[model samples]
Target: MKFRVLVAVSTLALTLGIAGTGAAQAQSIAQALAAAYDHAPDLQSALLSAKSSAEDIVRAESAKRPTIGASLGGNYNWAVGPGAVGPGGTNPTGAFTGSSTFSAGLSYNQTIFDNFATEAQIEAARAGAEAAEYQIRNTEQNVLLDVVQAYMDVMTGQQLVALRQENLTFFRAQLQSAEDRLEVGEGTRIDVAQAEARLAQGEAGYRAAISSLEVSQATFQRLVGAAPRNLSGGHDFSRLIPGTLQSAIAEAETGHPAILLAKAGIRAAQAGSDAAQAAFGPNASVSGQVGTSYSTATGTSSGLSGQLGFQITVPIYAGGALGAGVRKANIEQIRSEVDAMGAYDQVRAAVIAAWSGIQSADAQITAAQAAVSAGQEVLEGVIQERDLGTRTTLEVLNAQAELTTAREGLINASSGKVVATFSLLAAIGRLTAADLGLPVEVKTAVPYTQTVEDVWQELRTVAD
Candidate 1:
């Protein structure tokens, strides 16, 4: 009885382990996107960069605040005196003494004023943070688009394989019928040979389709960071595509990651310009120091020194460096403006292209669907005629071939429609995992601006 119980427990464990392994292998596209979102090194790097940019605000504010430091040391000295022996003077005297001294002091220097340069720098840092945020959004959009495209490619490839299998099955049935007729002398040998040739061709096509499907699935797995399993058929893309080109362009302008990032660049450059202008203004500072000193041969002494003063730094001479900086900043600002304008044009072009593609794909899908239906009807008629001895096997085979082609065409059209919809969304910067109903962890916004303001307040206190 004990042995039986142990065996039963072991069997249960093995079963559960196998089941878990199967579940792990069967990942959906949505799950893959979630995995990519969590595990992608690039996204993690971008987040770190954003955090680093945020830290820049702290560094900039530090420049306006009082800095405190301390120091300590010890020393030994030896003295020698040479003189003639007369009237309280020694002929030659040499003395050596060692003394240990320690001192610790805290000194503070605060920038009382810096012509708003520090403030401008803080603003620039804020803009940099915003740009980083936009970059993250851009990365997310690109990832989602890639996931969607790869997912659809896999699905379409699988559909093609299925269609090929169906065709092969039909061909095999026809071939069997033709052989039976030929063996009974009801059909000519040519019919049997033709059927055999058609079956061989279909088997080859099926094998090729299967190979293509596997390749597509593998590509999808690599992109999503996991193997895809149990993916449903393609989505209804009609709702995703805008009805009008104007609407599509408007959406792209409003939401496109590239456009937003470019706009952020313009703002950052503007902040830089402001900071450069502030460099020409006056700067003021206040300072304080306190120290305690001890000597081995002398008593310890401690004292505190405080200074409250204001200073204005006027840029008197820089050999044209300041002017050059200002000129460079202005040039950058202009360049950023041009880039932003170019981004807008690019967005518009993408929107228009996607819009046209969606329209064309929709028409193709409709036409393909109609063709598949008509082809299937014709194939049924041909099969009936061949069975009734009114149609030749060759004609029936041709009908089957046409029907297979039509079915494959329909699948391609459907897949094209789905891809075009995603392309449109990506063009507008609105392509995201959430839009596709994929699982992802949404981050809560940190009050970065408020954090910067709090640090600036502390700096003001130090300056005061």
Candidate 2:
């Protein structure tokens, strides 16, 4: 009897040893995450967006570079207005004559000075580029968190399906026993009917579990780029979390990518405001051009001309446009500061929420483990009582149902624990490929913007 009870307990409480089976080695969580990292389209899109942002700096730098160009032009005029021609005596209009003129030139212009407006614009662009880097990290955290979610969900779905299958098998046996007892006149038809009802219910539950598992596998394939097979679905993540909730909240508010991005945004807005203010100040520039022109047809002429000029433009009145621009820039600066404040609040809230989820999942797991242990003992006792004619068929069925419910609860809590832990990591901005040490090439903003500051080409694209 003890041996039979032990087997029943093991069936309900044991973790699936997927690796020990004859099947190939089970895929670890890190492997799944690595695959997702390499294949996720969302991550790739974030990288592209960062590259696009890097172009802003290049554009801003262009204002400081020299602008050189060359041009060639030609013109023709007919000589039949007032001059006499020799085609016929004293017939000016009788002869066809024309003068063709051509000109070629090269020009050079540089900012020389712009009252530091270009410098301010360059500073703003650099800040925006830095913000884009943070944005990339933020997107990475979100994608990794999503992968963690999909991984845990698939594991939980498989676990539920296994539990329900075992439960269904138990119900089938109970139904058989009840039928046998009725045939021997030891049980009533009502007992057999109850067993039949439970068997049908268990079958339905098993089918539902199967359907749920299929959906989870589809989601896993979409995220990880492969269908899940022989998943071990276990990891030691408890050590990764902070020792205290307060520490986690502190880390998130100060170090999270969203917070950093918002802070950079504030700097960008300040620089933009500076650039707008500089617009009202006087600016100076030097320009030079050299050209040659030639004409032919009776009055031949040729000459080479060159000129150098220095100009200063002061904005005394710009139809109120300059003041409006300054006002707008100041408002944007204020808005960016507000956004930083809001980012802190959001990050703090996320950390607290995720930490709470972890605590709740831990408590639930502990309780469910104890309940499953007690439930197995109670189920065995109820079965023995029914055999000894001290308990009814309905009592045995109720006990079995309770045990199954406890096992299901245990399964859910176990999976929830892992998911919640990952959520906490994400909240703290540590749920990244580097933190996990997954065997995959970690993509970063550096590669995407390696040469974004090179502004020699007029028509240029970096990393095209």
Candidate 3:
């Protein structure tokens, strides 16, 4: 009875395991991308960096605003003083102590002029923010490409496993037929042995295919934080390829995130140069303060004071620091120009490569399809001849092997075509989840509330 219970439990566990696997296999590529977009830590970090960069604009602008501040304090004081005595004679007295003193003040300042440095800084900050935004887009593109590739890999692996299993089934049936013929004396013992060997080879291939499929699935799961369930149907690559390489290159030049980022960097460097030049110009400011004080000896008093100031700062003697800064900025601008040129070159190269890959894979697919058809026809003819006793068992086995190879080759060719299509889209900067028609579950910003600029403004107001 104990042994019977153990068998029942084991059977239930096996059934449940298979059921779970089936469930996992039903997830789709769209679902996986959605999950990754929502939860991937790397993407989250990129988004945060973009947000922080945006706050820099506000920080730069804060220099132009008026600031106000207040402070309150109390103090005790002791002092020795000369006192008035009788008959108009002055006398040195003992120490006199004051028990309480209180003071409070409010102050304000405004920047009247600053040689346009503030404006230049704001421009630089805006450029930096734009660069950061491009970086976010670039990171998103990379993530999408990775997810698509991993998802397709899993699908290809699964398809290969299914193909191998089907091939194995055909081989097993053939082996059984050969065995029957041998038992009836219509075939020799060698024929049966050959069939058995083919069956063993097919089984080994099937196992290897299954192992590859498992690894692919694991990779997909690791990327998306969940196993992909029912994937989308086969891709249609007809619409992906551009009519001309020139068109693709043009699109990449205008739309590529990397190129955009480099351009923004150049603009930022220009702004930095402007700011350095502005260091030689003048500045003006205004300040005011109001305060009340209470003391045991002087009683309570209140006063208000205001000052309008205009200060001209000439860069007369900085030991060449300003010139060095300007030189440094010029060098950075040059570097940015080079980087932009490099981006253009990279995009051009990628477009050419992707276009070539697409054309090659398309031709390969056509040839593979024809080969599969020819191989199938050859296999059928050989089998018919064998059944009529005109062909040997070894001939039939060889035909079956040829058919298997043709089918596998066709699958690989199809996969290559699909991959090439996406590569071309990536080269043109058009590879996106939206372009792929993927479903997005959530579209929202990060969780943090107060921006860095907001906090900086509050602190500046207090300081004033």
Candidate 4:
């Protein structure tokens, strides 16, 4: 009966994470990752933030455009006595005593030039938006890596639970054998007691393993957006990883989103410095207004009044605020440069560490496989020797316990290998749903940027 159950459990393990197995569809890791990309609120928030950041480009670009406005107003006046003569007026002797006045105008202002200050601001905003877009990629990688780890955790948890159950069954059989031998005068009560102790310990371990599996399943559900079922365990990302640690580090330096974001930050800070320096240069603009108004008391239509003007303003001093801004921007630019350099170093270290983990797991899996085989052989030998009256029931139980531990180690090593390989891929910035060849459309922030940059953006809403 135990063997039949073990066989069924092993079969279930092999089919875990595959679809179309049971009444409920089994979700593959790829499907889980895709679902997470669609459903993760954190990722969704990051994408929305990227969209918001892209609007800054539109706002900055507005400075290059013209602004138009219109206004109207009226006032009434009643004279108590004759008005005195007004200087520089058509009716210099005295103005009309009871005249109502009205005015209306359409005004326009355009920034003809500002020493490229607005241009620098636009460039800075564009760079910042690009950096924000890359940050979405970083968030994508984070969510995908989380899904991978959670999936593997569920797979490994199931394996552990199965191993514990088998160990418990083995100990129960050993206890039965010990009691039988004691009844036949071939063993002492001590042997039965030892077997009972092992059985109790095995039961406790089995219960702990089940609890852990439940926790892992819950975590998997939270991340992948579905309960784990039929999770096939051949999840390996080593193929997507670089062939060597040095190559991995080089890839990370070039492609890591953090490093790219830092580079963009430097460009944005430099543009800010440029804009601040532009404050020292002469500013130029043009304005025009056209209007016509009529007053009821005068009973005359006021002819159109219009004026066009050009202006230039050069800053002589600004209470040191402009200089301070320039200095602050320069400092930030330098800091961004330093941050880019530091980002490269940090990414390189992560790649190295993740690569080392993969290499170590490879060795561990190999050694653990050998250990499990040896343990199985040892258990078989001890069982045979006990049947031949040369070994005690205690020895058989010890051998079986060793075999169970060895098998558990193998299971853990396998899981570690899978997760570490994925970590290495993520460190080098290639662990994406598209990179995995998942059958889902890869979402990108480029569409938002493109729409914002369009010359004729009549509709302001982003496409769904």
* Per-residue lDDT of model 2, residues 1-464, tens digit only: 54246437556345542212113687778888889999989888887777788788878888898788899999998854545656665654455567888889999898878889999998998898888888878888888788778887777777777777777777777788889889999999999899899989998998998898888889899988999877766677667788999999888877789999999999999999999999989888889999988776645546788899989988899999999999999999999999999989888888888888878988998998798789878888888888889998899889878877887887788778788888888888888888888888887767556566656444775555
* Model 1 residue 398 CA deviation in Å: 2.2
RMSD of every prediction: 9.8, 2.9, 8.3, 6.1
Off by over 4 Å in 1: 1-35, 76-96, 181-197, 234-243, 302-311, 388-390, 433-439, 444-464
Model 3 lDDT tens row, 357-441: 8788788878877876787677777777888889988898897787667667766766676666777787777775556566664
- Expressed as tens digits, the lDDT of each residue in 358-454 for candidate 1 is 7898898788778867876687677777777899999988987886777677777777776777788888776765665656665312454355447
Local distance difference test, candidate 2: 0.82
Instruction: Rank by lDDT, highest first.
Output: 2, 4, 3, 1
What are the TM-scores, per candidate, against the unseen true structure? 0.80, 0.91, 0.80, 0.88
Give each model's whole-structure lDDT.
0.73, 0.82, 0.73, 0.81
Instruction: Please give the lDDT score for candidate 3.
Output: 0.73
Best prediction by TM-score: 2
What stretches of model 3 exceed 4 Å from their correct place? Answer: 1-32, 79-96, 181-196, 235-241, 306-308, 433-464
Error in Å for residue 85 of model 1? 13
How badly does each model clash, as a count of residue pairs?
Answer: 3, 0, 4, 6
The predicted structure with the larger TM-score, 1 or 2, is: 2
User: What residue pairs are clashing in model 1?
Assistant: 112-284, 112-285, 283-313
